[model samples]
Target chain A: MSGYIEAGYISVFSVLTLYGGSLIIRVRKTEKKLPDLTEEKKD
Target chain B: MSEVNFAAIPQVFSKRAETATKIIGVLALLSLIATVWLGLFVTPPDQFMGNLVRLLYVHPPIAWVMFVAYGVAFLSTLLYLWPRTRDLRFDRLAGASSEVGVIFTGLTLLSGSIWGRPTWGTWWTWDPLLTTTALLFVMYLGYLALRRLPGDPETRAKRSAIGGLVAFIDVPIVYFSVLWWKSLHQAPTVLDPVTGKTYIHGSMAYTLLLGFVAFTLLYVYFVAKRYRLERLKYLYDRVLLDEAIQERKREAADFKAYGADKKSLVPTAFAENGPALGDARFFGTEEESVVGGGEAGR
Candidate 1:
């Protein structure tokens, strides 16, 4: 019973955190290049 | 295509927009963590299902969020396609939401499987709920794939928009499958048409409701972040395209100039192979005799 409970909690945590982490990673990567991209627009 | 300079317009989310995104993300995470803590330790185990019931907090919320994401994608696609409000920004939104929606959908399946393994004695079954969900997942996955096809931006948007619209039909079917058919899955615990109230109450119901709210905020953050990324990739690709077109134009110009010179622009042939250069000039004597004799007789 505790195993089932733990699995459920672990799954929830892992999924939500992973999804959030993915968003943060994407935002950082894209943000890093944003200046160059906008500079292109100006040029 | 005619060559044009592609300036990558960076979709800078304004400072205000960035701030809002951060706040939403923080709030969502905080609420979700609170809900998990309450569910795991604070809430009592079910008399019948026992602690396995904890999945109710996470599973239903995830499923609801996935639906919300798909709904956003569908509406955005519709806006893009409608003549009154057609725009590539909406297309960007549609594609972005669809990608996040796919991720959520996949997680829904994964979570469902984990919960199912304990309750159903197997990780998966071809149940109506499960089957329709799997179908929905694949359809949106197809929508994401459609976004990657090579073409002019407008054409690609139109194609992907149409795909996003068509793939959305499965959403309703997935939602209703449990009701319309004999499903092994449980009926809705939150909706009660007969009693007109939720089947749950107390801290249990409270946590579930908060889960929905928290995950909705999470969904907003996910879509916002993903949208920024989509715009970034779009701009980068256009920048590369501009470089390619420019190179091609330059090569074409050089080739055109070379061809024009080949036709005797300032005839190097005379300078290189003439009587002055000590090479026998073709028809030189004939030219001299004809011209000289005519001038002498005159």
Candidate 2:
């Protein structure tokens, strides 16, 4: 309810969400640059 | 020249592991949401700390994951160093885990500071636990930086494993700093170190437990994703290096066929409508051209 409590929760959640989003974006970008080796492995 | 054997590159994650990572990620997100709801709306404020105690649900869990991440990195480093078990995969895991650990460590410090501001009336302190934790953050950062230094893969892995080992020496110190020294930072709340008893009970305990599980799952998910990224980057660099090597070899062959006289030193590919001799573009870049020219001259 207090500003400190709100600040703590907001900061933690924001850092985590941002980091998670960045990781997904990076993985997608890197996957695009390389051939899908997972498909190659299947064949 | 031989073909680049794409099959030779190992898979970063198996199909089952990939599926498991996704499941873990979803579970982490759901549980994290639940933890926020329960900690904020459902749980009662502490008798003494009042509303400030809500920070407990998140701070300790983030700190716990920080420790676990570093612990995983330490073990991976050791595995990488062992002769029989030595593998670059362990090095990659160590690097990835340490990177994630650094993030969690940062969050731990940030949240801890926020709590401290209200409870202790100061945003920062010289307390042993806090100082050691800050030190742990810097040390792992140094470890990550060490990994990024230019070197052959084996050399870099070995150097980074040593750096990781050095950084991990502070982990236990950070853990016990509260007990080992007089400090403002509170001792472990979930499990009393002296009595081995849990202090909190009821919804508070359950919510805290959920926070732990949620963050732990998040750590796993993060490490999995980071490890895949490291592997992809490694493979991409290898592919580039292989291409560069193959190109150089072809140029060398052409030079040999034409006889490396002063006038005919240029490879046929370059001699015909390509970049001029000494042109950096012919060798991919200025730096590579200098090195390539040195090798070709020899």
Candidate 3:
């Protein structure tokens, strides 16, 4: 309700969302560079 | 002699595991949103702390996950150290958990500081609990840095495990700092240490319980994603190294064939640039040479 409460909630949500977004991006980028490991194993 | 078996390294999650991780991620997001809505609009303001007490739902749950993350890292470190169960998977898990722990620990400090600004009349303090927690954050950060240091896989894992063990010593101390010393920080709210009784009741209690579950699920989801990313990065590095080694071997074979046709005593490159190429160690079989080359490159 107050400024401090707003700050705390916003900070938690922003940090978490940013961190989660970065993880997804990094995983996608790395996956693109890599051949499918299961398919490679089959070969 | 302790060569990494890249073939043995898990490169991707099974389809079922991937699907399960996705489900957990979605559940984490949904529950977290619910916790936020309930904490902000639904729960009644505290009798003493007033509306400021809203911060409690997020702060304590984040702190709890910090402890859980570090505890997992410590357990994984111990498993990595045990000879009977030594595995790089445990090492990767430990790294992933510690990284996530660092993020949660950081949020705990930030949220606590925000609350303290109004409650304690200051943004920060040197109180025992606060100091020990800050120390815990820094130490795990050091452990993460140590993991990035260049070395062979086994050496890196062993040293990182040792670093993790050392960093984790601060976790218990951080938890008990409020109890161990006179401090501005309040005692545990959910579960009192002395009487072993919960302080909050009714919807407040349920909301807090939901906060914990939501954050815990989020922590699990983050760690799973991080572990998969770590595996992918390692596999990518190994693939590049294997390619480099294969190229080197091909060059060596071509040079040797050329030298044989010319009836030369030594290849000109080996003669001019020292015996780097001619050395038996350089031409050793892939298994023998990979570890040495990998360590050098790392």
Candidate 4:
């Protein structure tokens, strides 16, 4: 944690993790509606 | 047929992405451990460069991955723009790949400058290879900007594909710049002419190879994640469009049902207009409303 990577890179990794988390949130929201659509089509 | 649904993606794809990610993580850990061991303790200090030469282990792989990333973007863009394969999935993939490529290229440039400061007595250089590599990175940035530009999706894809092809010329130029132009950089030294062998020590060579493989795994994982995100975005937009179209159809149906049961409130020029007007109501309710209002006033 302390030796190889520099302090500046902490910000980079933080931003990447935040970006990835937001992407997951977006995917989940879209996924929730998909099942509802399928159920309606089936009915 | 199997029920292939998009909602189940994270679960369905998790197994493969997880296995791949785990392997990548473990390999990266081992590579880092081995790199530190060999770089710090095992490899003898260089006579001229002192400890600065240790940066070689990081520099070459970052450069290699940067080149590979742009290569992926170039090939994917070509495939995307081909007349037979101009599908939306390919278009999104090209954009995503270029975005990832630009990130890696930025890392390469940053790490190179850091290493250069300690060894070359400067933070930057106008060397041909460095210049061309920088140009390639800027080209990828342009590729990303093309995606964000305002236009219809099809037009954007076509224009971006042309940009991709035009910018990719810098790739080969970056690769061969050392051979074409003399510079402060050393020529490829690992090449052995007579026995056709690179006499890299086993430990150093092994660790560098492992690092390369680990970085490649990381690259693949990143590209897959980006491509998946782009696909989901496309699907989400498509589903919204379909819902809008269905809502419009439902509204049209409701309008027809209302017209059939309700009689006209205003007196008509012809009493027989009831049946004829009904027919027009069903066939051209939207158009009839405009014409009927005009005729009634006349």
Q: Which candidate is the best by DockQ?
A: 2
True-vs-predicted CA distance for residue A35, candidate 3, Å? 0.8
Error of 4 at B40 (Å): 4.8
TM-score of chain A of each: 0.72, 0.83, 0.78, 0.60
- In Å, residue A31's CA in model 2 sits off its true spot by 1.1
User: TM-score of every model?
Assistant: 0.81, 0.86, 0.86, 0.72
Error of 4 at B59 (Å): 1.6
Worst 10 residues of 2 chain B by lDDT: B289-298
Error of 4 at A34 (Å): 5.5
The positional error of residue B88 in candidate 2, measured at the CA in angstroms, is 0.2
C-alpha lDDT score of every prediction, in listed order = 0.79, 0.89, 0.88, 0.64
Write candidate 1's Cα lDDT for A1-43 as tens digits. 5576677668667866787787779767865654543333335
lDDT of 3 by residue, B146-217 (tens): 999999889999999999999988998998888889989999999998879989998889999999999999
Better of 2 and 4 by TM-score: 2
Error of 1 at B19 (Å): 0.8
Question: What does the lDDT come to for candidate 4?
Answer: 0.64
Highest lDDT model number: 2
Ranked candidates (lDDT, high to low): 2, 3, 1, 4
Write one digit per residue (lDDT tens) for candidate 3, span A1-43: 7899999999998999999999999999987887665533435
The sequence of per-residue lDDT tens digits that candidate 1 reaches over residues B138-248 is: 998888888999899899999998898889999999988887899988877898544567789899999999989988888888888888787777776776776777789
- Per model, the share of native interface contacts recovered reads 0.53, 0.67, 0.74, 0.05
- Tens digit of lDDT per residue, candidate 2, span B146-239? 9999999999999999999999999999998989999998889999889899899999999999999999999999999999999988988887
